[model samples]
Target: MNSVYVDLAIGLVIAFLLFSLLVSGINEGLVRILSIRSKFLWAYLRDMLDGAEGKRSWIPGTIREVFARLPFGNKDARPKFDPLPPPVRSTATTWSGRLYERLREIDHNTSGRTSIAFVPPGRFAVAMMEMTATEGGVPAMLEQLRQDGSPLYGPLKGIWDSAKDDAEAFRKGVEAWFEGEMQRLTVLYRKYVRWVIAALGLVLTLFFSMDSLEYGKAILTDNAVRAQVAATADGGAAALERRLRDKCPEHPSDPYACVTEILASPAFVQIVGNAPVSVRIPDTGDPQWLWNGGDWLNRLVSPAHWPGFLVTFFALMFGAPFWWDILRRLTGIKLRQPDPTP
Candidate 1:
């Protein structure tokens, strides 16, 4: 019985610790991966726009000239090229329109996809990574186009680089704002984690202390627990002997079996919660155990469960943030701020 209570208490503490660790690791790891990818994309785009690479590619060039003349850009920069053969002309127009639609869809989706981990490394890192990669990719793409001998290559490269640059700059500015918020977020995360762990610790400690105190009090009071032992020495022992003699007149071993069976009766189950009050056995100075409907009534009404589940519920809720942070640190993941605009 003593060992059972000790095991229960130890199990509760261990379960709480494991829950915290699991949540923390998953959240932090996600943040770090997103931040890294965002920075890489940003730097690639910037490098493309600045023409850091030697030569401009043709496909991106033509697309740039077309969009540049849209209502948003310089209207005067519109192109005046000769008409193409029917098949070539139709293919070029269809491809160009499809490309335009795709770009627009991507721009719309970018707003919803932003994350927190990008803030810690700062906007400059994002910008440099994006610009360098895109600028470097242009020359390589141009060589592919030239070898493939694709017509309308000039327009494609023009539009691609211009549109790509604008997107890179906008993303950089957004990340810059998030960078300013990173410090504040870090402080808030720490405070929340500490508060939860402390609260859970306090509750768990109280539960164990209260359970121990109650058991100790029961033992010292000579209440229900004390009466059961006294019963055996009084009528309980004699009744066992009489029953064995009646059942097996010639069997000497039957008396010991009878005694063992009496000791292991259902009447000896522990008094859990509000059970029947122990009855005072007449002339024995010991209590006789009987069901009084108290245990059933208490089981239905009482909120307390064995060791008190109040401590368990609080331990779970409060421990979430602390566990989240520990996992983030171990995984080198950044905590992302919730998007302010959203």
Candidate 2:
């Protein structure tokens, strides 16, 4: 009896693991397609550079202008911005206007690129140096900051004071500051990603009709089905574990390719085949086989199935790496357990 329950739990874990991988893979694809990381980085830089005093409210027009400047997406679709008049362009009086002109200069240097997806610490320090440049160097720059009434004046002054006029020390201080801010930014980005993962999990759960209760009952009641699922999971567990351990961060240029490879792997194929709840299109002569009105309606509105859908959704929200770790532990336990005597 205990062994039967163990088998059922293992089967469920394997199911969740597979589904989580699917959700994660789809999420990775979306991230790449939308250039989410790059956009987030750009937003962070905009806020940082503009400073509190220079910041503008994100009204509809402002939103449109920002959208037009992003480097990603359809270039032709972006709305054109009329060139500023010579006097206005040449004399950027306000601090915000000067910052904008500096960014424009940077963009021009980068072949008219409107947005920068990533900026290394050294490069950021260089940009800052250029932004704060004065004829008399650091002291003059500090005085300029005071005169301009820029919000960053305090922080810049502090950094400069600590550097004590050493150019190398000043650059390093700027780099350190950027690194510290980046750490905080990383945490915020992770939180945003969790919300995205949860949303994708919900969509995948509905699309696949992966009812946890139904799958659990099927595995628990049927000896043959349970045995098959357990066997398949056992066979493929090691391969899947290795695949999960392969870090995509090491291959940022094409992380989506790693996901695509996982989906195409034999282990994933086998596990997905053994999955009890899945969308399948029958090749039979019956034309109505694809459209099951009763099943669709039941899945849509049936309260009994709601709990199952919720279970699957939450399980997937746990993410692929999490379930892979569970799979490893459970597989170890299953192997360690003594087999029943005849």
Candidate 3:
């Protein structure tokens, strides 16, 4: 009885792991296509350097400006704005404005890119030093910072002052500051990614109709199906793990493509085929299949499938690495258990 329960659990984990891998691959593809990392980095930098007030003030004005210039729209259909001007503008003569202008110029010079997906600390420190430097170097930059009158001015001045005329020291200080901020930025980015993973997991669960309850029952009641799924998982799990680690490194320029390729591999196909789940989509061979919307909808929204759907959704979000570890531990336990005498 215990052996049967263990086998059922193993089968379910393997099935969930396969679906998790698919979700992860799809999410990576979306991330690359949308340039999500670059956009997040750009937004963070904009907010950090310009302050929240500056961002809030410019967004409405920018939207209006964009809509106002639309050639096809009604000439009088422009979005209404407050009669009062924004207290802070991107082009105003404030510290943020000046910094924004310099950064824009730098960005334009670098092949007209508006955002960079990655920035090394050394390069960032160098850019900051160059932005502050004048004909008189550190002393002039210090004086300029003192007169800037922005909230960041004090922190900027202190960083420079602490350097005590050593250019190398100043650069190191800037790098440290950037690294500290990056730690917080990383946490924020992960929170955003968690939501993305959850959403992708939900979509996959609905599309595949991977009801965990149904799958569990199938594995428990059908000895052949359970054995097939378990054997495939035992053989393929290590391969999948290696593919994720090795393939991505070999093709660093397009890790998402590598993930997609892995999903489409023969080994993965075998694993998925052995699983007992069924796709809810109607077969296109039927003449009226396209018109059978009610049948399709009924299968998708059936109350009996909801529990399994939720289970699959949460499992996928837990991700492939997690299930891979669980599989390893379970397999080890099974191997260590003493064989029963015939």
Candidate 4:
């Protein structure tokens, strides 16, 4: 085997994996800042609450008389309706209060909070089923609510209207409402996530004085460093795989379990065991490079320093699994190539 080329390949793999780990950590941090979980909660409550900001009023309302004493409509419909003296009128409570209460029961953080975004939707839905249940159960009550022009009639009516009142279809439609909202937010989040990656990558490069062009050249030319990095890569990757076997079983998209811990492992310590080379500007060949302020900007877009940082950020936007796949491909190439030794 051509140990030198294989070693250089390993060095590159380790470098990529190192960046992948850093990117994963940054991505997770960005997601936390973006309140990914809370956004879904907001989407859930938006469908249920009235007067929620940014709501589409034209959409049919999903409200129901949540406080009704019986599954049947108007109290006057009962034979013994309102035995009290005449002129005893009262106002009904809005679902917002009860909905908040429902959410607080599951996510205690929702207590005393006015924001609809804090409400946990799945729990609220279950609570509604329990509270509004009848002999025919939640579906039957929903059917009644639909006909009575309850708030739910707006968002869910189309499903029952089109699906011939299929319970599965109604459930799917209700679930889809929240999922669709979340999907839109996801698209926006992805854009912000990329921006966050770029910002974080910039800080990382500056902090470590990392120059990808220099590192690539060093790995190719410094035989001792390349050999050491290759050895580290082979062992470190194997160790990381063993550790990840349980955390990432059968799924590549499950947030790549324990990324921070894996990155801190002894294997990583060994991989970067050598002192880092100093970051330096790559030769531009432009004679006026020293005279121009634009040279700074030029270096950023150059495929060496800041641009390299951007490349790292862009790759990391795909998450750890993606780079791991690339590592595997690189490893495969290393295995297949014939040794160049005499």
lDDT of 2 by residue, 1-342 (tens): 788778778888888988888878887887666666656665565445444323442211233443344324333221112234223332544453444444443342232323434556766777566655632567776677677665556877889889988887888898888778778778866765676678778877776666787787766645443344445555464543443344445444553444444334333233233332434433445433234445655675778888988988988887777887888887774446676886
Model 2: what TM-score?
Answer: 0.61
Query: Which scores better on TM-score, 3 or 4?
Result: 3
- The residue ranges of model 4 lying beyond 4 angstroms of the native Cα positions read 30-36, 51-100, 108-153, 163-169, 176-185, 224-307, 332-342
Candidate number achieving the greatest TM-score relative to the actual structure? 2
Sorted on lDDT, best first, the list reads 2, 3, 4, 1
By summed lDDT, the worst window of 10 consecutive residues in model 2 runs over: 73-82
Of candidates 3 and 1, the better by lDDT:
3
How big is the positional error of residue 97 in model 4, measured in Å on the Cα after superposition?
Answer: 5.3
* lDDT tens per residue, model 3, 1-342: 788788778988888888888888987887666555655565456455544443342222333432232212222111122223223223334443344333442342232234445556766777566656522576675566556543455556677789887888988998898888788878866765676678778877776566778776666645543344445555564544443455446555553454554444433233233223423232245333123345445657799878878888888877898998899888874446676876
Could you estimate the TM-score for every candidate?
0.24, 0.61, 0.60, 0.48
List residue ranges in candidate 1 displaced over 4 A: 1-9, 19-180, 187-301, 318-342
The worst-scoring run of ten residues by lDDT in candidate 3 lies at 71-80
Candidate whose lDDT is highest = 2
- Ranking the candidates on TM-score from highest down gives 2, 3, 4, 1
lDDT of 3: 0.58
Give the worst 10-residue stretch by lDDT in candidate 1. Answer: 73-82
Better of 1 and 4 by TM-score: 4
Question: How many steric overlaps are in each model, in order?
Answer: 35, 0, 1, 6
lDDT of 4 by residue, 1-342 (tens): 388677666665667677768866866774455444344344334444433334542221322321121122222111112222212121224343334444443442323222233333355445444434421554565565565445655665565566575655555555566566556656644554455566666565544444555565565545543344445555665554554556445433332343433333333232232223222232354333122334444544565576555554554456567667777886774446777897
Per-residue lDDT of 132 in model 3 = 61
Q: Per-residue lDDT tens digits of candidate 1, residues 120-214? A: 43443343234324435544544544564434235334534555756455445435544544555456445434443444444443332223223
